[model samples]
Target: MTISSPSSPQEYIKHHLHSLQFGEGFWAFNLDSLFFSILLGVIFLSIFHRVAHKATTGVPGKLQCAVEMIIEFVDKTVKDMFSGQNKLIAPLALTIFVWVFLMNLMDLLPIDFLPYISQQLGLPYLRVVPTADVSITMSMAIGVFLLIIIYTFKYKGVKGFIKDYTLHPFNHWAFAPINLLLETVSLLSKPISLGLRLFGNMYAGELIFILIAALIPWWSQWVLSLPWAIFHILIITLQAFIFMVLTIVYLSMASETEDH
Candidate 1:
């Protein structure tokens, strides 16, 4: 509805941090994050589809050229990192990179722009940066984790996958239990670390933006914010690239039969 302007800096930061949430713990959903994420994803697909449909061999449009560049970059990255023969890896990596980059790109928007519009439309809260949300990042990580399991089974066979957990690091009957424990922790840590790393960086970036907005004088805000915003572009792009590369590497490791 009609959210009043915050009276103090703390109130302002708190208001900005709040999500448009529904339901209770576990069942609760961050509607803003979900909405923006899906919207950006659709936008990514639509732009690519339009470019591909209109693509010409001679004198390509700027949009087509940009799209082709991204596709080639992602294809090359996957080719370099993924040793497996699966056809899905390249497309998956491309989607992860572009989709996550789009989400992170939202953080560059003026912090109050969307929220102010949303307030006028009667939405109570809106957090536009989906990658800053732990649940969103973790959900993507879980998807990658599931793919790792599937690839391990497909390329290594069930027996090899079992041996990966049982007869690994020490490679002895006496060390099987210890190996299982160590491998299990390592396996679980993949998703956790993957998700948390993204969330931590983006959340911190979002917080700094909020602080700049809340604490700085309106007339002087741009003096500091402009430089930070420029630097953030690099951070967002690097985070997306790292996520995609790590996904490719993890799947490659899973596909290999030999232990590193």
Candidate 2:
């Protein structure tokens, strides 16, 4: 019987980055991303539900206090950016912040641990961070894009949305073409920015972790990897917060009646 050598660092990283698929060609589904993101969502929702079920008026528990702090922070942000309309906006913003933060936090796990375990269980691939996948990020951005369109029509009406796209900032018939072109470009830029910002940050962070894990001399790997991972806690949190805030801001802009 012949035994195979352990995979090289590059091979290991590449294998881990691959996704579990459900089909071939254009119909393939990224099962790994869907599974992990849904699992994380369930966990987050469970925790929030537990905290809500045990609410207190006199004294707050640690979990309640933490939840309240996050709620207040999200509420304040929405209030400042979104005005007092849109009853659903604040809760949605809060959920996005917490959920994305938790998803990004998955990067903190040991790079090879999940893949190794999955391999043992005969699973071919698993990419844990959904945000690190371009498809996932683009899907999220598209959802935001749809929400923006929906809110635009809801708050401003179909005519208002069209007017804003074709006539805002320049209300003359002669400049209609220019106004329409510029506004269309600006509107399209929102989803592109949303998708790229998240994909870039999470992808870069994952790449760095892979590179660091590839280093030899086990002692040196520990010495450097630990500090980098520690600092990455802040990076992941900030990226998630930025994504959430921008989603709220874009939605707010869509809901606004003014063009400026």
Over the stretch 1-260, how does candidate 1's per-residue lDDT look in tens digits?
45787789998899989899988899999999999999999999999898988999999988899999999999999999887688999999999999999999999999999999998888878899999999999999999999999989998899989999999888897999999999999999998999999999999999999999999999999998899899999999999999999999999999997777
Can you give the lDDT of residue 243 in candidate 2?
82
TM-score of each: 0.97, 0.93
Model 1 CA lDDT for position 177: 96
**Winner by TM-score:** 1
Candidate 1: how large is its RMSD?
1.1
Q: Give the lDDT of residue 187 in candidate 1.
A: 93
Q: After superposition, how far is residue 167 of candidate 2 from its true place, in Å?
A: 1.0
Q: Give the Å error, residue 215, model 2.
A: 3.2
Model 1 earns a TM-score of: 0.97
